[model samples]
Target: MRLRNIPGAKESLQQHPSIIIPNPSENKGNWKAVFGNDNPIHVEVGTGKGQFLIGMSKLHPNVNFIGIEKYDSVLVRALEQAKEEERPNLKFLNEDVEDILTFFEKAEIERIFINFTDPWPKNRHEKRRLTYKGFLDMYKQILVKNGEIHFKTDNQGLFEYSLESFSGYGMTLHHVSLDLHRSGMEGNVMTEYEQKFSRKGMRIYRCEAKFRA
Candidate 1:
């Protein structure tokens, strides 16, 4: 993904203190205080343009939603879209995936969503993939016991690789779909990339994996 630097994007995000969490590391374990409630927190990692997070926030009003995106340019687009709505349960985080553990404590997050993350197709970059064991281990640290990961992608290679990664890590898989759109699955939320790829006749793969004790 070639990203064009958006001038003042970082400045804009900083200005919206209510929508964007400033110094997320400080509020690590006390996320409920940030939302002013004890409702279960669900996060979407690599939330490009925030379509899925925004939609989920509105649909599930009782659940708090956080969208984490690393790039300022791409995150700014999500911020702009979220600004139009008055969602008290929705927030955005401009942070790298590698520092994820620093922003949350054990059993802090109830659910995680990974939508169309970068495949990092090179074998040498396998560890960098979001579904890689390294990343999964990081997720396990913050996620509650039995916390679930919902993942979807259009890349077959990444999907296959992720299936193995999740299974190898002892995550029970369910609702595995090779062609999500045609699978007639209900309550499916489409991300920006999911919509774009599905329109071009690309197959979307989806699965739900839960860490078992």
Candidate 2:
């Protein structure tokens, strides 16, 4: 379905004015107050085409979702799905993840999902990957004690590097899987990238990382 033509999307989003953060720089420090809910907040970094975010929003209504995508062209689809589902619990930010801390208050988030993030495949570009220590450190500040980061990707090197980064930062790893689709992992929801890669028989990697309390 085309995002722009999603029926009632314009109106539904208007009623839920806070669903889109217009000026993330100005409001990131007080996001919880803007959301007006104490429900656990979960973030999906690199949310593409909105499939996973939309699907998970439907599955978990009590938990609020904050989808961050740098490209507005991609984020519009997420907004459309949220409107179609009337998912009162979903919001979106169209900005780079580097400034993610600006949009979320300290200890405001409980969980984070990193799905199919760009695998900067150069030795020098490794620092640009979201799983790099710079980004993870930002996440640590916004996530409460023991808050977890869930990562899924098809890139082998990125996955291996992420594991090392997490370990070096003293993160506790749980529910780790090297070949997720073949690991007998049940109840795993498919994201757009996961669906495409798995259909072509590509293996997936996944893990749950948490700060040690």
lDDT of 1: 0.94
Residue 149 displacement in candidate 2 (angstroms): 0.6
Off by over 4 Å in 2: 1-17
* Model 2: lDDT of residue 181: 88
> What is candidate 1's lDDT per residue for 1-213, written digit by digit as tens?
689999999999999989989999999999999999999999999998999988998889999999999899999999999999879999999999899999999999999999999999999999899999999999999999899999999999999999999999999999999999999998888999999999999999999999997
- Least accurate 10 contiguous residues by lDDT in model 1: 78-87
Q: What TM-score would each prediction reach against the true structure? A: 0.98, 0.88
What is the lDDT of every predicted structure here?
Answer: 0.94, 0.83
RMSD of each: 0.7, 4.0
Strongest candidate by TM-score: 1
Kindly give the number of clashing pairs for every candidate.
Answer: 0, 2
Minimum summed lDDT over a 10-residue window in model 2 is located at 1-10
Q: Once model 1 is optimally superposed onto the true structure by TM-score, how far is the C-alpha of residue 133 displaced, in angstroms?
A: 0.5
Q: Please provide, for model 2 over 49-93, each residue's C-alpha lDDT reduced to its tens digit, 9 standing for 90 to 100.
A: 788988888888888888888765676667777777777778887
